[model samples]
Target: MTSLIIGVLLVVGGAMVGIALDRSLLRRWIRNRDPRRHHPAPETRAASSRRRSARHAIEDAERRVESAEAGQLSAETAASRVEASLDALQAGLVLCDRNGRVVAQNTAATQFLQARHGEALVAPVIKDLLEQARSGELVTTRVELHAEPRRSYEVRAGPVERGGEMLGAVALVHDITEHDRIESVRRDFVANVSHELKTPIGALSLLADSLAADSDPEVAAHLAGRMQIEIQRVANTIDDLLTLAMLEDESGRPGARVDVGAVVAAAVDRISETAEQNDVKVVLSNRTAATAIRGSRLHLESAVFNLLDNAVKFSESGGRVDVVVEADQQALTVSVTDEGIGIPATEQSRIFERFYRVDRARSRSTGGTGLGLAIVRHVALNHGGDVSVTSREGFGAKFTVTLPLDSGD
Candidate 1:
């Protein structure tokens, strides 16, 4: 019995140790699973749940931050593209606030501002123009800039308004120096034409009165012949003027396709008699074979005839005039070279201008209306080409007419 009791006590002690070890393991697992339980009583099961929810909320916020960063990057890229495109435009652009302060500017605007840098406090001109624009009075004025080179600009300023409230002003500038010069020249040409026409008409009128009053046969005959020549001159000038006007008008009209070779041949034929009378010969360097250009047939023929006539008139007795037609892939070049009293270098540039002559007395004696070269130039330009002259004081002159082979239109 004593041995049995000892064995039983030993078994009970082993079971108690096993139970304590199991409880210790369970506590350790609970502690590892939930570290918040180590806090005071305030951190209960509900508090643990709240902490878990807070962690999830923080993770959601982090995800939103990453998404927002991506969106910001896209917006920045779009803005950069817009800015780059705006910079590429040729027009000047400026952004200003309601107070007429320049807030933003493009490359064109910056360059324009720099050009006007010498004006009163550089900023004041812009401010004043903007202020004037805001007052409902759009200012359109021409401003001259003296930079490395002189330039004329037409500056236009207008208001930018929203809901009847003045926001700012936008200014646009155009370089019109060349345009202005052309307009000036056009005005002078009109005046010159009026004066030229008046002289012939007045002379014809005076001669007609004299012939009507005079009963002498010889005097009347002389005056009538002179009047007839003047009338013919007037008619020729009017015809040339009309031809030039038609050439300068809109294209795609009737008689647009002109056989350039035929026109040249016809001009040579028409001037054959005159060439013989002046003892001048017409020599054609036939290289084009035959090519057609888009121009008024009559005008083209007249242009060629004018060139040939001028050559024959200016050539010396028994001088040979060469007419060369050089046609290439891109352009057709018609050059009329004459061995005559060549034009001076200083007068070459203005020879093509209407009523412009190197020697007025000589041009009048030659019976030239001074519109032949001008008409030729107009025809060349209308056909998308240009006319150039190279001459020395003693050496002969070469007048080249370059016309595009193909009309891209």
Candidate 2:
């Protein structure tokens, strides 16, 4: 009985141990299928946190890549726009390194900076300005470029800096050739006006004194007539000056549409009495009936009248002055050809200048103010045309005024 009882106890003990082993194996298999069960609660929480952090890190990396791409695109667009704006500017622009070497320049820089024929646009003035800029100085200067046609430029240069660090220098160049020319013209005009007025005023004063002192009525009358002629010349000069001043104004009248033929006829009519007095024949030849140009009628008439008057005044007795009007696609041309003592080739270029006279004595005798051709030139220029002359000394002369034709004409 004792042996059987011991055997039963051993069997029961072995069965309990087998049951514990099976339970532990089953727990291990469950832990292998789902790793969360393999560790303590704190360790499982830490692993879950690590997984979340890795996923967030991947999303952040993707966002950074996207942001970088956007920034790069925006930068490229901005750079392109800046380059295009720089190219469209008319003023010359130049960029230089801190060492004063050229890095970039616009097309106008080549023209206004005197960079023709492989010459450097960074002139001595520019170099000096760059040096000053690199030293943190803002500079502005008017520098004339050494070039043909003699251009004047206003240059402005300054430092290109960021965060107190200098990158290089930049310069802007503005052409002032037209302004200089106008200023010169204004000075010359004042001087010429003063000189011309003095001549007439002095002559008038002297003649009036002589008339007052003379006892004979005949001598007084001759002196008075001479004064009248001088007074007329003075009046004409003032009128021409006023016209030129009006033309120079920016708000001046553009002009009116007028028939070239009618202007020629009126001009000829105005000079008829003078022509007869000089014994010069005046003939009008119209090659085109439809010669039309847009311009001030009074100015046009004055131009033609001056030409005819000049021709008649210079012509010898019985010489013929022919007014020929012709037209082509580009222009309506009125040419006044005269048989007169012609202008020398050397003097021809300067004859159109205000107050310039080739033969001062002859001009005085004929009461020429020396501003007729000058007036004609300005009138033609205002009308979008020009005046040119062809002459051979002692042979004859032709003064041609060309006005641009209206599109329909």
Root-mean-square deviation of every model: 7.1, 6.7
| Candidate topping TM-score | 2
Task: Give lDDT tens digits, candidate 1, residues 1-409.
Answer: 2221111123464564222334555667878889566664764768888999999999999999999999999999998988888788666666677787787777777775665454322334555677888787788776676663456766677899999998888776566767876887799788868876887899899999999899999999999998988888788878878876777785643436777878888888999999999999999876876468777777677787888888888888989889888888888888899998899976786788887777777766777788899889887777778889888877778888887877622
Clash numbers, per candidate: 0, 0
Worst 10 residues of 1 by lDDT: 1-10
Which regions of candidate 2 are displaced past 4 Å? 1-48, 80-89, 111-122, 132-148, 154-172, 245-258, 276-281, 292-296, 314-320, 329-331, 339-365, 381-397, 404-409
Candidate 2 yields a Cα-based lDDT of: 0.83
